[model samples]
Target: MQNGRKQIAVWDVFVRLFHWCLLAAVLISFYTTKTDGAPFLFPIEVHAQAGYIIIGLLIFRVIWGVLGPTYARFSTFVYGPKNTASYAKALLKRQEPRYASHNPLGGWMVVLLLLSLSFQAVSGLFLSDDIFFQGPLYGLLGRDVSGELASLHALNSDLLLILIGIHLVGIVVHALLGEHLVPAMVTGIKRFTSAPVDEKPAYRTKYRLLAIGAFLVAAGVCGWLWFYPY
Candidate 1:
């Protein structure tokens, strides 16, 4: 937590990059759906490109949530059922402790959102619009299987809307309570507390070359899956 412009790094560069990339990918994908069949450069490539980026970000995120900074790692926020229930109770009473990172309930929400988005990404690889935009992984499944996966993908995406709405509501509630959680994520700086909720420990930092390498390799795979069509 920062006190009067004190710098405490809560988010690594990789984390911030992944966050923005995923946001862009999701927005592009939704836009393409809204404007499907529009004629432009390549005439229908943006959604496919966006899907590849979404998957890449999701892969990077899963790896980072396991091995990133102290505040970013899963172990930092993932809590037991008791903690989640306690947080819920506190929220009802308007007394939930504000965490510099994710709170227990919010932590589970993060997990759920990640899992749901990942599932949607994977299923997207195997889904078609039932008309055009058939995925390259379409061959791995029979017609019936592809249809089922497409349905699952749509179902998951619909659920994501509800979850995101809930998250925005939570954010607004926190802001109303004078806790600027959204800025902490955007600026990677949390406001200070007298009782010290969690100490900001500066960990020796370096990007995992292997992760970046693997990401490039995944880009290769994405190309193969999108363009080369096995």
Candidate 2:
């Protein structure tokens, strides 16, 4: 249960909240999209609202990566492809080291998933089904452009599914190897074997302010997507 002599503040509370919120939003969106024929206003309204909520959570995540805790920042783990290859090789050899934060390969997966989902959200902003919700950007485009964007948006959703699969599999592998990676994300505590003993922790008050600001921006954007259309 313990790996080192010291405890490190790995992930913050807001980061965990955002992660779970995004997961819920994705599940709601999936259910609504998949069961459109069901006779229920709950699914209809919830799906539309959940889509916007997912976008909002993503906005918070991107902002948090820049201005949150040390382990929560992108700069802490976004390594180059070479580093990923080396990490991958180590992983294959069962020699990869556990990190208190995201390892290099895992870190880029975070970036890739976020970026791909960001594109999905951006495309969703312009998508309208004439069924449930009308995207604000729908009015600005002609039928052809709107149609093309809609198709891309539909196809891009599959990418999110694929990315989710990869992420889940990685977590499962870690679990099977006796590593509690998921709990680390949930509880923000991780065990690492080789860290030094007397490292000082730096505290920051700006992170709370940054997370709050991002959450507000996310709320505003999601509200606009739900209630307003151009």
Q: Identify the leading candidate in terms of TM-score.
A: 2
lDDT of 2 at 156: 77
What does the lDDT come to for candidate 1? 0.73
Task: Please give each candidate's TM-score.
Answer: 0.85, 0.88
For candidate 2, report its TM-score. 0.88
Candidate 2 regions with alpha-carbon error over 4 angstroms: 1-6, 36-39, 42-45, 196-206
lDDT of 1 by residue, 1-230 (tens): 24443445676666777777787778777666666535545433677778777777777676677766787788988999998898899889987776767788778888888888878878877766655467777758788898998788778878987887888887897788776776777777666454335556854556567457657765776666667553
> Which pairs of residues have clashing backbones in candidate 2?
none
State the RMSD for candidate 1: 2.7
Q: In candidate 1, how many Å is residue 125 off?
A: 1.2
lDDT (10s digit) by residue, model 2, range 1-230? 35444456677888888888888878877877777736656575676677778888888887888877777778877888898898899899998866767778788888888887778777776667787667767757787888898888788788888998999998888888766777877877666555622222544667777777888998998888878744
Angstrom error of the Cα, residue 179, model 2: value is 2.0
